[model samples]
Target: MNRTPEDRIVELGLVLPDVVSPAGSFQPSVKSGPYVYTSGQLPIVNGKLVMTGKLGQTVTTQQAAELAAICALNALAAVRAEVRELSRVRRIVKVVGFVTSVPDYSDQPAVVNGAGDLLTEIFGRAGTHARSAIGVVALPRNAPVELELIAEIAD
Candidate 1:
């Protein structure tokens, strides 16, 4: 039998990686009213940061896009943990994604679509949300992608 979303998460081997550790001493996530907001999550595996540098430079756009998706997945893990269950996720709300890009790169938004696309695939309609794709010089830990999430949960 196929795994449900929760089981698929486990099958995909996601372990949440200890909530990314509050790089500048801010909480990884905060609950305000019925929403849980997550800080940026980098593509990390086995407690070590993976995929670094500017897109279209040290990293290809395709690679950066994939990293961006993983970052969103991690963010989802954080949100699900906070809301206590995936079932509480009423809507994705918004996703703010940041990409490390070279000065001339104008495909930042396309790269971030990797995250948005995955969210839709996983959560179906609930994953559709307001979004922002930001381009920056660098991200924490020099990661190629960093993503933040805002999710509305059940009462």
Candidate 2:
């Protein structure tokens, strides 16, 4: 039997949270033609940020990585809200992650792997995509990590 992406997420002991409401003036996700683009997602759970602080200072790398995963899950939620089904996703085209870190921190790639790895685990080969992990001085809400995704969907 074949499993859907949502099933795979459940198998991994992960549940997609409700889509985080936009903090400013943008939609959480927008579908254009055959693609869906998600706004940057933070690790907010139940209306509160899971963690806040710089990656190399008040937050540990491991914690930041987990937060990155949470951000990815939130991104997925936004996609689902727009597309209405995970099965519509044909390919995860791209991922961009941002990590708020102290000046000495340079392990942004490793931190973002948490999101990349989870997407691959859920969607298998379709999850493979180009990605960028960037470290910055700060992020909105002082979040440790943020993530956004672009996915190709079937009409």
Candidate 3:
């Protein structure tokens, strides 16, 4: 708990990539009062999706999970851009993950754990939050996974 979330990210050797530009009219993140909400983030690096295709089709659960982690990092980047620092986050309030999957793929929660686990590692107890994992047939840019986060800012 002594280590800050930013410090934990560096200790974990994970770099938050640059925030990707929103593909549409919406902002990447919006801060209102004590909370910051990030738009859906894809598993993109340097402006390109890491992988495409549905789970149980061309992507495996593990791969999707990794991609979901990348989405989490991207979400953090968006949050940082809005709030100016991860240290300002008091806790992660909510997370919603979407996975493009084959009809029979019923392990959406497992994939979303990729994001949740990383957040837990970086923020410790504060990372725990209410979450929803959804399965869909498609996503923007054909990303295998996408996630959004709601973070409460410290006063």
Best by lDDT: 3
TM-score for each predicted model, relative to the true structure: 0.89, 0.97, 0.97
RMSD of each: 2.3, 0.8, 1.1
Candidate 1 lDDT by residue in tens digits, 62-133:
888888888887887788768776767788899888988888888988888988887776677888999999
Better of 1 and 2 by TM-score: 2
Better of 2 and 3 by lDDT: 3
> Candidate 2 residues 33-128, lDDT tens each?
999999999999999999889988899888888998999899999999988889999999999999998888999999999999989999999999
Candidate 2 residue 134 C-alpha distance from true site, Å = 0.6
* Alpha-carbon lDDT, every model: 0.80, 0.93, 0.94
Residue 98 of model 1, lDDT score: 90
Task: Give the per-residue lDDT digits (tens) of candidate 3, residues 1-155.
Answer: 56777788989998988899999999999999999999999999898889999999999999998999999999999999988889889999999999999999999999999999999998989999999999999998888999999999987
Candidate 2 residue pairs in backbone clash: none
| TM-score ranking from best candidate downward | 2, 3, 1
In model 3, the runs with Cα more than 4 Å from the true position are: none
